[model samples]
Target: MKARTRTNLWFQLALVLTLGTLMAWGPAVPVQAQDVVVKVGNIIPLSGPSASVGLQGKQAREMAVEEINAAGGIQSLGGAKLVMLYADSESKPEKGVAEAERLINTEKVHVLTGCWNSAVTYPVTAVAERYGIPFIVPVSVADKITEQGFKNVFRIAAKDSWWTRDQFAFLKDLQEEFGTKVSKLAFVYENGDWGKGFAEQWKKLAAEQGYEVVLDEPYPSTATDLSPVVQKIRRARPDVLMLVSNAADAILLTNTLAEYKVNLKAVITSGGGHADPSFLKAAGENARYLFDIVEWETDINKPGAQEANAKYKAKYGQNLTGEAVDAYLAMYVLADALERAGSLDPAKIREALAATNYRSGPGMIVGYDAVEFDETGQNEHASLVMVQINDLGQGLERITVWPKGARRAGYTPVFPMPAR
Candidate 1:
């Protein structure tokens, strides 16, 4: 053989050996690549009146997805990664319905969450139930949403009556501790389902607790002027003001109260406007001493609650809403179900979720001892906390006050709120 022919033979032998080695070792594929994708959809007010609450929820859900994906995705289902989708409900019931249908039909999401406002939640939930999609509500407090007996719908937050029950206990404790009895209450709530649902229960509960309902005023959720209603409350001379309005109305009512220099023993603001960041900003100094019953709080002593909040604030430039915290927890709840399911089938995931007993890891981050769904698809173990806005050294902090489980409460409740 000539030298060129010998060289060609050597090159061909090297190529053969390299091919054999490549075949034996396999291709250079990543060791951690996910084999499947679990798609979930979130429907909240990304725009319009209630966007403040919705925006926080949106960030929280996104953060949860990011955290879950970072933790090597789901262990079962061949390391399937979670994919998030969003639909803006615009804070309207009809819009919520439209967006939910779009997400289900177009986006092909496996499970759904949100539609924050109770008015929106009611209609949106109906749509999800109609389509056989599992819908987990993180924020809406309307009891009838779950009372309608839909298995596909689930709620992680306390029901409307739960807040009222907690309120009664708080009042009882306040009277015992401070001798400032709230015998008379003036109700000012919007006309929506949340406002109406809470007010209806509040009226019955307040009366049974010996609280005289002085003036039950129902205003439009979009009402910009609450002066007339404040005038009614002031004249009624109620010991406590019961507020069940949205963020905009909450801001308006608080500002109007301050402007009129109305004084009361205390003000009980249901979560809507009372806990909203916009209510804090818009109500200004008037927000101080305003007692709010909330589902979640940053000051909770849960292991990772504050750290999770810090990460949230770093990105969002504000504190997270109680609803937002719940939304974050919702993702983990779904992820837990997906992991146990070990399959992408919606029915299997629903079954796994129904059997969820998530007490650790990302699922219990909301401070609930255990997250187990009841027959009605509501988290029976879910509860709420009471937070009061106080002038802390840093600024206005909504410190948890009523619930003894709260990690930090600055002082005894401030009885007979000072005049503006």
Candidate 2:
């Protein structure tokens, strides 16, 4: 009985000391909350043909993540810091799949993003879905990525259907505005999911618009020599050439077309390679008067666009392309969702993302107003803008022209492009 009394007395003293410490500190902070880290896995092509755009995406994500962390991180979860893990897909579907599995099962990443090539993203989405991890696609414009009915897939860019629709609309508007009739249309594109999806829509749109299809050509983007393709384009003798190409191929096709002097009324391009900064330097005069559709341009008149572009240019030594802008905005979107989620659970984060209606922030530099997603995980507010590559005394810059309302002030588009 005496030994039991002594043990009870010691326990009482220890409890009193613990209460005293708690009172001194006012309240106890949960160590888990204060030290929580959100791990994000990113899979992008760091090498291979698409490396330029992939590097841009990586740089953009780094910049945004730095800004987010510096601004006190996710406030909702006791200031949890976001941790990023990167995997290079090498622009291969198999590589993307392996990386996704490793990131999900081994790296234990809470969320996943990327595999910029639609072909790569397509297979990686299945890996992510199998594991139930949230997959965020910034710029893979394939419509079927979201059409898979997977709950965890969310895309931030306009799908191929939307892009194709806008391209046709711009074409029609150009003809109407300048009183120049465009009848024969040639479709030349890379033979990939993205290009084929676009070509399919282009065919239907061409038929609906009552334009004759002069040439339908699908070439591999990796083709080193495009003289043969240019010859085919020249032989087709189409009034307008509608092209979908990647960076190297875009430069190749542009220069080759110039070398062969394949004169046409206009050259409308999908933004993938044509909007790349290197396209301007490599294609030079050849890329002039080319109209490309994109999500954002350096000259956009949005609130924070100039500042953001200035910062990105200062850091990366180049301007941001439509693909890079989506990546930059994506980081901001993830941060916003994390703040609302207040938990590291992927489901919570996905729910917050689905409910996201991000309108204003540093990342609102996009051409659109908001970043709200539709039921199918597609950003409904996302839209495309057409920009003409011309020298406005600024030494050949991309100037917004289509959608008339979004066109730059005091500038007129040169229709029926001048001959070289």
Candidate 2 per-residue lDDT, tens place, 233-322, comes to: 999999999999999999999999999988999999998899786899999888899999988777887777888889989998998877
- Global Cα RMSD, each model: 10.7, 7.4
User: lDDT of each structure?
Assistant: 0.82, 0.89
The lowest-lDDT stretch of 10 consecutive residues in candidate 2 is 26-35
Q: List runs of model 1 lying over 4 Å from the truth.
A: 1-33, 47-52, 90-107, 117-120, 173-199, 210-265, 271-288, 363-369, 407-412, 415-420
Candidate with top lDDT is 2
- What TM-score does candidate 2 reach? 0.74
Pairs with backbone N, CA or C atoms under 3 Å apart (clashes), candidate 2: none
My TM-score estimates for the predictions, one after another, are 0.72, 0.74
